[model samples]
Target: MKYKVCGRLGKNLKAGWLALVLSVLPAFVVADEPPEDPAHAHDPANVWFIGRGGQLYDSWMATTMAEKPWGNHPAYPAIGNKRGYPTWRCKECHGWDYKGKDGAYRYGAHRTDIKGVRGVLGMEPAEIQKIIMNETHAFTEDQLPHSAVEMLSYFLSFEQIDMDKYIDRRTKKALGDFDEGAHAYQSVCALCHGYDGKKINFASQKYPSYVGSVCARNPWQALHKIRYGQPGTGMVALSNVDLGIVVDILSYCQTLPEE
Candidate 1:
């Protein structure tokens, strides 16, 4: 017997095929999405959330949408007030380098004579959480939610990098291949910071703080920003990039004009 194709049957078959394709499309789309970075896979929170914690470390008041701690930070008189708003920032006292008075802020205007967070580098996240809530830090749940606290704690516990490996403290320079860094900068950073590395002046035009300025003045801060990105900005973290490449990028950035 010869089989004939019916119009109605053909239409039904077509509809069935369309429905099948639609059902399986999502799986393919999800498969194409990038996987979480393994570097942070062991952390209590995802890298992005931990990055938010880093933002909190920079300015908890800004990150949590809470008021700044009232009055001098209690330690203010000893550390001085040259840093202004940063005087209230964790980075101000501990240093953006995360080494506190023992490192970057050891003798500068940011000097506080306080110990660095390095001592707690590998502490448990939960333990770090308690430290923040303690009388010294005095952060309450009302100001920083449990989630925020967790993220911050996780960051402090696991995210601090050793600056000595990537930066030379004596010269305040990146310890990487400048040529390689120049290429990386041209490929990825030039789009935003421009060839001169002055497309964005993070500080006022009068002082004109560019990528070069940041690298020259604080290679540690530049390295941190390069690794994790500037919080709450369009800045993309080079977390996936090799640390050596990042060091190279920093080295190139140091060549830019500071003023």
Candidate 2:
């Protein structure tokens, strides 16, 4: 899909802000310069996060679909209904699950016309971010603040994930050895998620089997949370954990009953 600016930053800005804007986007000239720094995870100008944020920004913001290129922009901004494209928020279309309607927002007005960013699994964070920042992608430099870019840096640098190797699509189980994953789960998740893998009650309306259910419905969602961590939840991303170990955990999760 062609990338177009849906919105621009507010006019009220200081010299630094204006400079940042210019540096982020120059008129007419499409420069494919790599990010300025690779080590700096907190700077938008950093190669790692900006690139990741760019992809993420694009995933939620840009439209490639020929049927609905706009991909259901929010007619109103308010959660229930306000004005000016309420659906513009990333959370609106993709749902908190990031698996799009296939996950949490499967039903409701927020239910939209596409899938989620979970397909980004296995891609390098920088590569993923590049897709987000591309003109035809979700985020435009003019549309977001430096902090937002930085936050994307944090996500791409620290949060975004790659799940392809971890899950077994055929058997719907994890594929790696489990020693480290066991240790991590016992240390961090056993109390709430439980040793039996049933504490989360994902099957019930009140609770769901975090592991079992996610694997059955969409393993990609599980992989994303494992990497980036869930928003507003106590769960944290496991960037330090080896992907092999994560696969072990998923393997175990696939063993659980769906109901």
Candidate 3:
């Protein structure tokens, strides 16, 4: 039976069977080994880390689980206080567009006359880290872990997008298809923000800040959040999706009630 299985005459059967066995051996060995995880699963080279870094930049205090800096920032006197953790937010001074005084916050309640980090683009990540820890910035390693700082640096260095391309800063309108955006919003955003995007009151009722308010008032910030998600929240980042979808969602959100 073994000789017949080898498909050879009696004398050559052993050699033929040996050749067959040798050829098939590697297959069994490969099958015994566990399969590797998907390439997207926790890959160090994945751009998702950059998105997380963007989230950290949006609200380091929230991302790092660190206490907000006590009192106002040294430069806060010129900017006025709005109270709460927002005062300590990096975007509070830098502006969501990263244009700081040169951009959206140039003359708003968030104005601080501070230069944006736009100049810092393409800078060495290490240099950005040093600036973050510098006395002027005064971010302590204790407050923000090295990893978190590195992530923030990565975001500033690589993930800062040009809002001018996707939004009309003057009109505060998203440059996307409204119907497409509405569909995207109803699919996922409506779960927390509601069909009208007013289910969640990110700000006080008197102030009446909602998704629409954010989209209309600070489109840059809204775009950043939509791309990277809010820190320390269940809000999912849409970084992996086509950015046009994000712009579309922003357009739909703009149609919601702002006040």
Shift in Å, residue 98, candidate 1: 1.4
Which 10 residues in a row give candidate 1 its minimum summed lDDT?
30-39
Q: What is the Cα-based lDDT of residue 159 in candidate 3?
A: 60
| C-alpha root-mean-square deviation, candidate 2 | 17.2
- Name the regions of candidate 1 deviating beyond 4 angstroms: 1-45, 82-85
Model 3 Cα displacement at 91 (Å)? 0.7
Top lDDT prediction, candidate number: 3
Give TM per candidate.
0.77, 0.48, 0.77
Ranking by lDDT: 3, 1, 2
Total backbone collisions, model 1: 0
**Which TM-score value belongs to model 3?**
0.77
Q: lDDT per model, in order?
A: 0.78, 0.51, 0.79
Between the candidate structures 2 and 3, which one is better when assessed by TM-score? 3
> Candidate 1 on 152-217: residue-level lDDT in tens?
777777666667767888988789999999999999999999999989999886878999999998
Question: Model 2: how far is 13 from its true place, Å?
Answer: 63
